[model samples]
Target: MRLSAEHAHLIRAQALELAGAQARVRLYGSRLHDHLRGGDVDLLLELPSLPANPALLAAQLAGRVSRALHGRKVDVLIDAPGLKQLPIHQIARSQGVLL
Candidate 1:
């Protein structure tokens, strides 16, 4: 996916803030394009371990990201080693481009 300067910057900043030093964040899908319809930002975040409160983290990240990006929708995908059983999880493991 090709990312514009603004979107790329926002994604990188948010990814780093949300993952800190442990996780890697990857942006995927149509939102990566320039003339796109503000589709939900597809993110794949790979973390070393799940947090104590996953829901809270998701909500907090969503809120912060939404506010940062204004009208754009943000979809965050938090990944971890534990999800190896799932097929889609392979994206998080292999295709992720660290933020």
Candidate 2:
């Protein structure tokens, strides 16, 4: 993983705070590969439920991540219950490394 210890710690902590204790986080995309470089952190947050204003929540999470990373890009994808199934979601959950 390309993430520094601080990065990983902040990510998990932020996920817990943004979602809940029961929430699970996964790391995916180019950042997960050692040979790859200069890509944003791709995170999958599996939550029991989703907020009504998910875009606002995502933006808030982005702000938190940006502060921690000192402006580095972070992509947060929420996997909420009862959402319409999509192939991208399947790929993310299946291929992503659980954190």
Candidate 3:
């Protein structure tokens, strides 16, 4: 579906807010394009500091965003520093667009 400007605005605002607490939140995939559809809100979230419960933090952030914006679909990917060695993930880490 064509995401309305209002929806985009809400996404941007929530993303910025989430990014403040995490390492970095990048908006990726078709949602970033001005004209695109049938794609989820792709988010590459990086957490610099390794908290006691990393998954918990990620889940909380995702839950807050999902709850705050009812009916909005989002897919959050949390990338912790010094973990995972996939090339695509690494590329996303280096070349991804930061929100």
The lDDT, on a scale of 0 to 1, for candidate 2 is 0.81
lDDT values of the candidates? Answer: 0.66, 0.81, 0.63
Question: Model 1's lDDT to the true fold?
Answer: 0.66
TM-score of candidate 3 against the unseen true structure:
0.63
lDDT of 1 at 42: 66
Who is ahead in TM-score, 1 or 3? 1
Error of 2 at 12 (Å): 0.6
Off by over 4 Å in 3: 1-22
**Candidate 2's error at 77, in angstroms?**
1.0
lDDT of 3 by residue, 1-99 (tens): 245566555655665575555466766667656666566566677777555665665676667666756745667776775655466566666655675
Best lDDT among the predictions, by candidate number: 2
The alpha-carbon RMSD values of the candidates against the true structure, listed in the order shown, are: 2.9, 1.4, 3.6
The C-alpha TM-scores of every prediction are 0.70, 0.88, 0.63
User: How do these models rank on lDDT, best leading?
Assistant: 2, 1, 3
Candidate 2 vs candidate 3: the lDDT winner is: 2
Report lDDT (Cα) of residue 82, candidate 2.
71
Candidate 2 wrong stretches, greater than 4 Å: none
